[model samples]
Each structure stands twice: as structure tokens, then as C-alpha cells.
Target: MHTLDQLKQYEKEFIEKGYFVLDLNNMEYVKEASDLLQKHLQKITNNSEITLYNYHAFFEDNDKHYEMQFQMLQFFREQQFAQNIIQSNIDVYQFLLGPDLEIQTEPYLRITRPHKPKDNIGYHRDTFYGTGPGEISSVIPFINLSEKSTLSVVPKSHIIPDRFFKLNQVVNTEVPKDSKRHKMGFLYAPKVMDPEIRNDVIPIPLKRGQALVFMLSIIHGSEENNTDYPRWSTDIRVRNSLTSLNEAMKAGYYKPLKDSATTQTFERLSQ
Candidate 1:
């Protein structure tokens, strides 16, 4: 367990950069959790393409799926690993927003599997998807990853509040010749408001079970999973309690819940 002071240091890093990696100090828990999750995922998926994109849990038949398309957090909750995440969330919110801050976990799970050449997600901010007015997000690696498999991000994109990336600009881009997206779907390449700011881009590589937390407005994306092995990771967002979807529903930003997976509550995410 980390002292509040240590968590504050991590929060300072996040304040300076858009993201910070937790030392996670719980390798045994991660190994056990990862093994269990991988086995669980295998029982439901053997599809080459969907597996390549880390899109497995989208199917209703894949055990008890929750959130976006992945079901690992459900396992975390069932296995008591959720306690660790909750503690981190509490410490993090306190460190970043003071003790008065509250946090809420939304119902979206992003599991990314960079397989083959073209499955990388394109450069975009979470605001594009309308996730509410909170900055905290967690990315947990299910496997140990090398630099080639790390997520590459533009460090302060979230701080660039005046500029927003539009869906249209990204849609018209030609996939890079060196990118895996040419063969797969579309690659997630990092874009900057100014190409001259090369120092803004950083590649974050993580150990199995270690998670990186960042702001949602952060301009981030990933590179091709070029290794012979598959790279799998999961992302979940935490909204400030005051900006929660439950509050948004009362504010009339979102309709009552429906079965639509892609449906979003827009008011919390953007104006």
C-alpha cells in the first residue's frame, strides 16, 4: 500500500504529463488475474479478426460480459481485485482533486488487442465518444508488453482545450505506409497541433496487470502490434462524482438506458 504522499507524487506527474503509470506492486495478483481472464476469454472467442482487434466480449454468449465489449473487470469485481482498483481510485481522486472529490465508474470497458498489422485505433480523444466531464481513465495491461506494443500518446493534448479533433479530419487520412492499419483496419497514430513539438509524444510500455491512468481529453493513440505475440489491454473511465452519467440523466443529457452499446450521453462529454 502507498501512502497518500506517494500517491500525490503520482498525481503531480499526471498533472504535468497527461498520463502516469502505477508501480502496481502486486505482480502475483496480476498474474493470477491475467491467467484467469485469458482462460475465460478463450472459452468464448477463437475468431481471428475480432480477436485481433480485442473485440471479444462484445458477444452476449461470452460469459457474463459487462461495460463496453470486455468482461475482465467483472472478474475483478467477483474475485475481489476490485478492492485494489477502488482504493487506487480513492487515493487518486484525493490527490488530484482534493479530498472533497468523488469518483464514479462508468459502464464502458475498452479492450484493445493489436494483432496482425492494421488493427491500431486512430488518433482521437475520448471526448469524441462523449464520456462525460471527467479526466481520469485507467488502462490495464493484461500481458507484459515491449516498446513495440506500447501505447503512444501526445503528452499534453488534454491541455489543448481550445482545439478539438474532429471525426471528419481523421476519417480522410490515408493510412501510413509503415502502419499496420493498411492491412488491418485503421491505425491509431498520434497527432499534434504542432508537429514541431516532438517532445509531447511518449510511448508507455507496461507490465502485465499494471495500469496507466490519464485524463480523457488527452490526445492519445496506439501503434501497431508488430510482435509475433498478441497484445491485450483493458481501459475503464472514472468520472468525477459530480459529472456522473446518473447526474446527466437527471440533467436530461441522456435518455434512460437502452440496449444500444454505442449510444452516448452527450451533455456530460461536451457542450
Candidate 2:
């Protein structure tokens, strides 16, 4: 949990740099998240020692990337993934998003196979998908990763002029050359952004259990997995309490973060 000042400091950094790091002193959540998928991995590959990053190697159909991802997500929802988010930043949800919390996506797992540059996701903003503003994406690596195997982001892209990487200007791109859409897909190569702005993209490296929180407006995307080990990370979206989620948002689209009375009332009423 963070103090009011700590939370505000993070908010300042997030606003200025387009992202902030929330470190988990106790790494138990990473192990718990991994354990939740053990049964499924065992069934798929009879390999008990397989971990998140290397789990994809078990699949003979390399193209089944999305299918594997869906399976992991389904499993993650049943675990304590949500609890960890709040525990990781109790004040963040309160001070950042507010007490009326809504978790947009069930925390999701991302796996990048090794030596697959073509599969790397191109740069893009989450706002382009119409997720609304103040949306935060939480990313935590399941294994220690080199800089080359992590997410590359353009800090402060959100504050850039609207003329930069506008929807019509740049298109979605995928890695691995002719590969389909990337698992961590966002905006790909920006053909229109000026040279100075384009040079801002830099790789962000995080070790196991460390979380990086970024506003949805930030321009970010995954880089290729250049190491022998695959890169496994978790991603979840969240919106604040005041955001008037429309009809398309649905009832379960977001959930409360803490044990606040507001969340308790929502649970009882929804039930």
C-alpha cells in the first residue's frame, strides 16, 4: 500500500513519463499466478517444470498463439489475480482511479516466443481502441527479462500534438514479418510521426514480480523476444470510479478494487 504522497508522486511520474513502476516487495503473487495455470500446462504438455515464458514451446502448432493465450486468460480469472492488483496499489486505485473501481480486463497473460522479431507488436496507444481516458494498463513480467525482450514505449507521447500517430496516419502492424496480429499488438510502425518524436521509443525492462503502470494514452508496444527464453508478462486494464461506463461497458466489465463501502454496495446490489 502507498501513502497519499507516494500515490501522488507516482501519478506525477506517470503523467510526466507516461508510466510508473510499482514494485512488489513480496513476489508471492507471481508464483501464485503461475501456479494457477499449472494444471492446464500439464495437460497440454506433460511437462511439469514448464513455466510461463517457456510454456509456449510445448505447442507444435506455433500459430496457435492466440488460442494458448485465451486458455491462460480463462485460468487467470479463477485465481487471485484481481486481489493482487489492489494489494499492489491500494492507494493507486483510490487516489488514481478513485473508490468506484472497475477492472476492464481480467488480468491477462502475454507470452512471446524466442527469436521471433516478426511477432513483435508495433507501437500504438490503447486510447485508439476507445477504452476512454485515464485507463491504466498493468504489466508484470513472470520471469527476469533482458531489455530486448521487454516492452518498448515512447514516454510522453500522450502529450504530443494530435497530429502525431493519428488514427488515419498510422496503421496496425505485426511482428515476425508476415505473421498475424501480435499478442501484445498496438500501433505498429508509425510512418507519419516526426523523426524527433519517433526516436523516443525505448525498451522498458522489468524483472519478475515488478509491475509497470501506464496510462492508456501512452504510446507503447512489445518488442521482440531476442533471448532463448520466451517472454511472459501479465496485462490488465482499469478505469476509475467516475467514468460513466456506457451500455457497451456491461455490468461485469469492471469490478471494485478494495473493500470500500462503495464496492460492497455494488456487490450486494448486483447480486
Q: How many clashes show up per model?
A: 7, 10
All candidates: CA RMSD (Å): 10.2, 4.6
Runs of candidate 1 exceeding 4 Å displacement: 42-84, 87-89, 98-118, 162-200, 244-271
TM-score of 1: 0.61
Query: Candidate 2's residue-wise lDDT over 16-63, tens digit each?
Result: 988988766457877666666666766675678776656657653555
Model 2, residue 156: displacement in angstroms? 1.1
Best by lDDT: 2
Candidate 2: C-alpha RMSD after superposition: 4.6
- Predicted candidate 1 versus true structure: per-residue lDDT over 1-271, tens digit per residue: 6677778788788888878887665566656656666565555555333432244324433222223233454554456443345454455555564433333333222344445333456456666555566546677676777777777678867778634443343432545644423322233343333433335567788887577778887877664665645565655544444444433233422222112222234444564
**Native-vs-model 1 lDDT?**
0.54
